[model samples]
Target: MLKARVITAIFLLIGFLAALFLLSPLGWTLLATVVAMLAAWEWGGLMRLVGIQRIAVALLLGVPCTTLMLAQPEALGLSGSLDKGAALSLAWWFLLPALGFWTLLVPLWLVRRFPLSGTAFGLLTGAVVLLPTWLALVLLRHLGPWALLGIMALVWIADIAAYFTGRAFGRRKLAPQISPGKTWEGAYGAVAGVLIYGLAVYFLSGSALALPLLLLIPTLLVLTAVSIIGDLFESLLKRQAGIKDSSQLLPGHGGILDRIDSLTSTLPLVTLLWLVL
Candidate 1:
């Protein structure tokens, strides 16, 4: 598993660098949309929306949504004067439904006992899990490569820190019901790692720090917490479905969704922060 993970990481790093430095920003946007669409496909399966209808629905819903999100600055709102920051903020704010839906699913999971049995319920749940994340990716990509890289770095740092911390010292389970392996210690590590990473990026980019390091630290910490929630949220979904990982797309990482769960939650918040403050 570790070897596979290393291999996958190498490939992902190569791809990301290529996209960031070699490809046009437009190309990055296109690639991001494609990834979003693929995630939507995986989401359809998780939702129990299988067969041709599932594909059709996912494409119909995911494609236009991804396109509009990516094109939001120019195509959807405020015409030419549309603020990228504002648009990202709005997207994050709009993700409330997805968050609410996930919260609601907790009770359902506890009550239904066999929650994943119903196709309709699964489809709705899947939509809640899938759409926001896809939209977040679109918004991040649209924010330009720097913003996208920043978002990605946060997720990556969180995951890496969480893994090492949890392995080194993980006595208390953070969410044993959802993901037994996750630990509070690891969660804290994730927060710390991401905040430090955010600070590094902020300084390295030579961007003016409108806010103090203290303020930025807390913001990144909050974003890291949100990212963990996103991972646990998806883990809960998979647990109820009697599945492990979102898909077998990656040799060790599971699927795109598995790799991106943190980003799914963090990106929107980052986008919102970038715009609002």
Candidate 2:
């Protein structure tokens, strides 16, 4: 299992890097759309929408992404027509609600253990979970592949730290019913890891995007918490749906959603910060 995971990680890293640096803006949008499509399919599986229902859900979410890209490439930083202000304004239409969903609704949903049922609600929830993420992927990459990479690395650093720290010193479960493995110790480790990573980037790059240590530390802490919520939310849904992984699409990695679950929650907020700050 470890070997399979390592190999898959290598290939995924290579492919992602190639796409990140090489793909045209439209190409990146298409690729992100494909990812969103597959994630939507897996999400449908979680919703117990089998066969045609799953495909329809995939199309329902995926097609509009492409349509929006084609109609308003400038809004995504794909082509230059609209100014940055206008483009950012358009992004808020999707991302503002996404911000609300992640920061407010998601925490409550997790605490209350709300049922993810009803076709209308399911679709709406999926849209809320997905579309901003798709937009974030495009906008962030456009902002600069390295910048996007650094933010993503923060999540990876946190997850890795949490995993090992949990194994070493975990005493209290973070969410025993939803995910048996996670613990509060792991959560603390995650925060510490991101703090170190944030500090390193701040002192090293000295970039304008690197908020001051005061602002940066708080933002990283909030993002770390938000990332955990995203992971747990998906875990809760899979448990409710009676599945282990979202899908077996990525060999040892499970699926795209499994890989990008944290990204789904973090990227939109990062993009919002990028625009506003």
Candidate 3:
């Protein structure tokens, strides 16, 4: 399993780096669209949409992304929208609200453990989570490959830290029903890891973004929590759907949705911050 995971990660990294460095603006849009298509398919599974229904849901979500990529409309408001696509313009509408949804609303929903199992609501949920993330990737890449990579690193650092910390010191369950493996200690470790990562970023390139070092900390802390919310969210969906790993699509990563679940929340919120700050 570990070997498979390592190999997959190597390939994923190679592909990501290739896309990051080699793709033109439109190429990146297409790349993001492909990701959206696969993610939408997995999201359909989470919604319990099978057969034609699965493809339908995936297409339903992916088509909008495709339109946004092709149209590149100026009305939606995006920095890099001029030549690439209107992904952010359309994305912001969803992702802006998503920022609030993941930050404040999701935590509450998790605590309550609402039985959100209806198909209509499930499709809506997929829209809320997947669309913005797809756009966020596009927007981040537009900002600069390093920008995307740096922000993404925060999540990676947090995830690794949380894993080790949780295994070493985890006691209390973070979400017993949704995910028994997660713990409060793990959550703290993730935050601590993000803080340190943020500091490193600040020292290295924070000035380039024009965000102050101190100011960046609070936002990173908030996003740190948001990243955790993203993970538990998919876990919740999987529990409700009665599935183990989203799908066996990847050798070790499980599925596209499973791999990018945290990204589904974190990236959009970060992109939102990028627009405002």
Q: Model 2: per-residue lDDT, tens digit, 76-117?
A: 877753357856887888889999999999999988989889
Provide the lDDT at 117 for model 1.
55
Top-lDDT candidate index? 2
- TM-scores for candidates 1 onward, in order: 0.79, 0.97, 0.92
**Candidate 3 lDDT tens digits, 1-277:** 9999999989999999999988877788777888888888888888787899888887788788767645653522233444333444565587788987897889998999886678888888778888888878877787778878888888888888999999999999999999999999999999999888788767876452447876787888888888899999989988998998888778898998888888888999887767666
Query: Residue 249: error of model 2 in Å?
Result: 0.5
Runs in model 1 lying further than 4 Å from the true structure: 1-4, 66-129, 142-144, 201-210
Candidate 1 vs 3: which has more TM-score: 3
lDDT tens readout by residue for model 1, 1-277: 9999999989988987787767554455567667776776677666656678557655755655655646564522324444565565556545666555434544355334344556566655555555666556555554556667766877888989998999998889988877899999999889778777777877987542245666877777767776777788678767776679777878888878888877776665555455566
Our model 3 lands, by Cα RMSD against the true structure, at 2.6
Off by over 4 Å in 2: none
Candidate 2 lDDT (Cα, 0 to 1):
0.88
Question: Candidate 2, after superposition: displacement of residue 41 in Å?
Answer: 0.4
Between which residue pairs do clashes occur in model 2?
Answer: none
Which has the better TM-score: candidate 2, or candidate 3? 2
